[model samples]
Target: MSKKPVKKQDPETTGHSWDGIEEFNNPLPRWWLWTLYACIIWGIGYSIAYPAWPLINGATRGVLGYSTRAEVAEDIAYFKAANADLREELVAADLSEVANNPELLHFANANGRAVFATWCSQCHGSGAAGAVGFPNLLDNDWLWGGEIEEINETVTVGVRNETNDDARYSEMPAFGDILEEEEIAQVTEFVLSLSDDDVDQTMALAGATVFADNCAACHGEEGLGDKSQGAPNLADAIWLYGGDRETIMQTVTNSRFGVMPAWNARLSESDIRAVAIYVHGLGGGE
Candidate 1:
């Protein structure tokens, strides 16, 4: 049998050329053209059905009202609802006695770690060994009280924050304006002498008098610090900002005002209690 002869059409080209290479004016394949059209139609449909257009404040809520955040919220709500009974029991139970109940202790430890990792880990590290400005939760050196009740209250209300009405509040006088530079330096020396074995004996002696007159009212005469006034113990080697002579001088001059957010505004009562229990048991609490 004889095969039919193939037709040879002249090649088409656009007016564009680069050296000897001519631009072929070829049409896209039929399947490829159809796929492109389908994609365009799908994109339009998707935009209409879901949030796509950007607005001044936020994205447009599409006709379907599909929101990833909303879905996530719903999922969270479902899980929260599932744990409602345990949470209610936790909230009702006294935090001091939380460890007595194995179920409650187990639940608190498990959930508290999760909550701490999510919220507390940013400031306090994942291991709860805080950064320069942040206090280490693992240590016994707490600015505020370290009892289970105290921890719960601190976590709930926070320290030096404006949001919570019952927040732990204290103000260290900016000695830069109040005292002379030499006085500030002397007091800083005395403060250093509390923890550091090597200190200027003469300057520290002079600072003893200055500390009794100005700082003793809050920091105490012995430099052990007043927990009632939220004053940190300077007698110990654990320093919040730093233990260096330069850092001590700066602290004495300017004063440190660290702010912590009130978890009560963001977290549930049970969650706060759980975290408090978790922190208290971390070999730090009194």
Candidate 2:
């Protein structure tokens, strides 16, 4: 049998053509088209099953009533439930006992660190190194005693806070108005001598008399501060303000009164105890 020649069929093209190029009108591949259709269906199903549409007051309550907020609440509830016993034990345990139990100590430290970072990092540095006019937690120096109970007490009832009646309160008399400028300078040199810093021998000798008359009652005769009076030890290099001559002069002339907020009303009892432990364990607690 003789074979006939096959004819070539031209592909359909749009009317527009540019520079010998033409656009072919081709149908999408079956697989690709089906995939796109499936995606659209999935999107519609999702819109119906979850919160997707926005309304006037709030969002839509989808068929499944799924909510991100509800999910988060559930997760929070689960977390609290898991940690409830441990937290209760921490709350019930004595402040001293917290450190004795390994698990309790670990939990308290972690929570206390988080709490410190959130609440205390602003005044105390992120590392709790402290700043000018702020007491450093890393050192053994403490205006109040550094015992765990004392620390807890100080934290509960802060220094110079007005809200708490039993707050640790102390005031340095502003000697700028009380004494002559020369007298202030003399006392500054005397204070500097307490730390064995180089100072004017004659003026410090004279200032000793002035210190005995005015400052000895609060700051001991040796300048070893009284914890009962909340007076800072002047014999050490750890100065809350500055240790320089000028700074000492300013302190003597104007006096420094700093305030720390009472956390008793602000934080839970367990939280306060935890922070006290955390601060005490920072290599400074007595």
lDDT at 230 for candidate 2? 92
Query: Please, what are the lDDT tens digits per residue for candidate 2 over residues 153-270?
Result: 9999998988999999999999998889998889888988988758898999999988999999999999999998899898887799999989988898889889999999899887
lDDT of 1: 0.90
Q: Give lDDT for model 2.
A: 0.89
In model 2, the runs with Cα more than 4 Å from the true position are 1-77
Pairs with backbone N, CA or C atoms under 3 Å apart (clashes), candidate 1: none
For 17-91, candidate 1 gives per-residue lDDT tens digits of 899889889988999999999999999999999999999999988899999999999999998898888899999
Evaluated with lDDT, which candidate comes out highest? Answer: 1
User: How well does each candidate superpose onto the true structure, as a TM-score?
Assistant: 0.85, 0.76
Report how far off residue 224 is in candidate 2 (Å).
0.6
Give the worst 10-residue stretch by lDDT in candidate 2. Answer: 76-85
